[model samples]
Target: MLPVDTTQLLKGVLDLAVLAVLRDEDGYGYDILRRLRTSGLTEVGDASVYGTLRRLFNAGLLSTYVVPSVEGPHRKYYALNAAGRGELQRSGKIWQDFASTMDDLLRERETA
Candidate 1:
């Protein structure tokens, strides 16, 4: 078997990544897009991020606020709420466990 494309694999965890980003600070759509790009997730699209934001907001994991910036239009910023923080903590632990399992499997295959 060939090595997995981690870029493709990352799609499964994009929600978690977004949650983690929001954990840093309240930010607008474009700011979140830029931050995710800067973090080496070059495949992420702005629309995808926006859609995720909407979904998360609908699910009550995120709360949005309008912020006025002189340079541009009023921005709708997203902040993680208590529910979101708790969800992130749970998901983070689960991801760690899954990653550890994958690492072990890959290492075993490499040795074999």
Candidate 2:
């Protein structure tokens, strides 16, 4: 299949993506980056993930804490707060509805 230009698409959904990941568990910067990649967001960048984390924290959607590491400096872990959870729910529903519409459109095109 042709490669999709996910940059624009991702820009709109990065907040939802990052929040969704943290919903399950808290993670440090690099850990969150890895999770995003492992979960098939291969084009996601580290800077984008870090920036999203900071933005979400500042927006009161995320809570953060620092944990000391033996191998390096302390790591800051991020977790979802009540506001974040609510945002996630809202965004997820919007995404699902939009995706369903897109699927319907694509199927129509295919059948035309």
Candidate 3:
């Protein structure tokens, strides 16, 4: 069997992952990327997370604000709006269902 490309899998679920992270609190681009890595998605890239934040904001699912930083430059934070929350819930359900199906399939193969 061939090894699974985690990067490819990350691409398929990057948006969902980003949304999930933002569900608890708002964060800047780099901070969001760090959260994903800390959550075991070390394969996630900076550009990908930043791009996802931009795309999500443009899609009307996220809101952004600028916060002045004492050390460096101002940070732009992203937060989920009503639409974003709705998308997160809907997407989460879809992911759960798909994951469950895949688990069942793998378990069957293991038993067989």
Q: Per-model C-alpha lDDT, please?
A: 0.91, 0.94, 0.95
Q: Candidate 3: which stretches are off by over 4 Å?
A: none
Model 2's alpha-carbon lDDT is: 0.94
Task: Return whichever of 1 and 2 wins on lDDT.
Answer: 2
TM-score of 1: 0.91
Instruction: Quote the lDDT for 80 in model 1.
Output: 98
- Give me the displacement of residue 50 in model 2, in angstroms: 0.6
Candidate 1 residue-wise lDDT at 65: 92
Tens-digit lDDT track of model 3 for 42-63: 9898889999999999999999
Number of clashes in every candidate structure?
0, 0, 0
User: Model 1, residue 58: displacement in angstroms?
Assistant: 0.4
Model 1 weakest lDDT span, ten residues long: 4-13
Model 3, residue pairs in steric clash = none
Q: Taking the tens digit of each residue's C-alpha lDDT, what string does model 1 give over 1-112?
A: 9997876777788889999999979999889989988999888978889988898899999999998879978999999999999989999999999999999999999999
Ordered list by lDDT, greatest first: 3, 2, 1
**Candidate 2 clashes between residue pairs 3 or more apart in a chain or in different chains:** none
